[model samples]
Target chain A: TQLLEQSPQFLSIQEGENLTVYCNSSSVFSSLQWYRQEPGEGPVLLVTVVTGGEVKKLKRLTFQFGDARKDSSLHITAAQPGDTGLYLCAGDSYGNKLVFGAGTILRVKS
Target chain B: SQTIHQWPATLVQPVGSPLSLECTVEGTSNPNLYWYRQAAGRGLQLLFYSVGIGQISSEVPQNLSASRPQDRQFILSSKKLLLSDSGFYLCAWSPPRKLQETQYFGPGTRLLVL
Candidate 1:
């Protein structure tokens, strides 16, 4: 089974603090996706990385895919209260199937 | 523009009761549909996925079952509810054109078994 392990299951920081969440796996994936979920809602797609060593940025968020396609990271710069949520990383294994990481719960207090 | 809709934002049912959750997509055709469950403090668990009508793939064998009666509609049902089944259920869809397509998620349904 393909499994993605996420680090720092819970993180709480004050506003303007920076943090990074990591997702690692032994199995290589064809693609990886990052999502942000708030309470009482489904996760929203933050970014998708398909190629090795690829980087994508969305405003204050930065996403990176590992060189072997077996890991990924999400970095938030100057986090605000609005950035508080559960960050998840998912890896595509087969056709339309995704293996998800444990997830990182972030809380940014303003 | 594409959108996905999941019904009954929240539900509280007694144990052993039947359960049914519906999901539908609009503005897209021949999309891949997926059902995922998320427990508190954990990530999503792939429950079921449908590539086409009447084609369902189970990721984990459990009390849950899924069906797709049409190209744009998917349903999750169970004959008996389990207390462990209570969680946030999310429905998602992706256009089947790319190998690594991004999925769009619905508002989701929160089920609580009492």
Candidate 2:
């Protein structure tokens, strides 16, 4: 079975602070996606990285796919109170199913 | 534009009660549907996926079962509920053969078993 391990299960930071969350795995994936989920809602797709060493940016967030396609990272620059939520990373394996990491709960205090 | 919907936005049930949750996708056909569960502060746990009508795949071995009766409708059910079944259930859809493999999610259903 493939497993995606995420680091820093919980994070609490002041507004304007930057943080980085990492997702690592031993198995390779065809694609990796980042999602942000608010309270009482399903996850919302942030970005998808398909190529090794690919980097995508959305507003104040940046996502990176590792060179081996076995890992990914999400970085938030100057996080605000609006960034408080659960951040999840999912990888599409050979069976066309997404294997997800445990996720990181980020709390940005204003 | 495409949208996914899951009914009974919130549910509270007894431990031995039967379970039924509905999911439907609109504005798309031949799309892939998925069911996932998320415990408090945890990531998504893929329960089932379907590529077409009457086609279902289970990823975990548990009391939970899933079915796709129609092209755009998926259901998750269980004969009896367990305390562990309390969590947020999410339904998602992805366009078939999309290179990015991005999934759009519904508002989700929150299940609480007592």
Candidate 3:
């Protein structure tokens, strides 16, 4: 099974602060996705990156796929209280199945 | 305009009890359905997926099993439940014909096994 490792399992920051989360893997993937999950709810897709070195922006959130397609990162600028949630990164591997990282819980304090 | 529904938003059951959770998707056809389990502080684990009626693929061997009885209906069940089964159960769907398509999730069901 493909494994995706996420860094900084937990993060707390004051509002307006910036934060970044990283997802790394040893195996290459066809595509990668980022999701945000609020309490008691299933994760919602934030973005999907298909090409190596691809970058996509969703408002204040910026996502980057590594040049090797083996890693990805998410950066939030001027974080707000609404930005708090559990962030997850998933990789699409053989059979079009997604392998997910453990997840990073982020809290943006007001 | 697609929506996925999972019933019994929260369930509390004693150990060894039979388990049945249902998921149905509306507003689409031939969509890919998936079942996932999320333990505390863990990521979503793919348990099963189906591309069509009566076609199911098991991703991990465990106390849980999944079935697709209709075009857009998926079910997760177990003859007997275990305490370790307590977690958040999620059902997701993606558009057909692509493995890398984006997936939309349901509201989710919280299961607690005592």
lDDT of 1 at B44: 88
Model 1, position A83, has a per-residue lDDT of: 94
Q: Candidate 2's residue-wise lDDT over B1-114, tens digit each? A: 888999989999999999999999999998988999988858988899888899888888998999999999999999999999999999999887542277889999999999
**Which portions of model 3 miss their true places by more than 4 Å?**
none
Q: Over the stretch A56-83, how does candidate 3's per-residue lDDT look in tens digits? A: 9999999999999999999999999999
User: Tens-digit lDDT track for model 2 on A28-69?
Assistant: 999999999999998999999999999999999999999999
Model with the higher TM-score, candidate 1 or 3 = 3
lDDT of 3 at B103: 88
Q: State which candidate, 1 or 2, has the greater lDDT.
A: 2
* lDDT (tens digit, per residue) of candidate 3 on B1-114: 899999889999999999999999999999999999999856998899888899888988899988898999999999999999999999999999765558899999999999
The lDDT per prediction is 0.91, 0.92, 0.93
Q: What is the interface RMSD of each candidate, in Å?
A: 2.3, 2.5, 1.7
**Could you give the fnat of all candidates in order?**
0.59, 0.63, 0.65
Query: What's each prediction's clash count?
Result: 0, 0, 0
RMSD of each: 1.4, 1.5, 1.1
The pairs that clash in candidate 3 are: none
Model 1 regions more than 4 Å off: A94-96, B97-100
Candidate topping DockQ: 3
Q: First chain TM-score in every candidate?
A: 0.97, 0.98, 0.97
TM-score of 3: 0.97
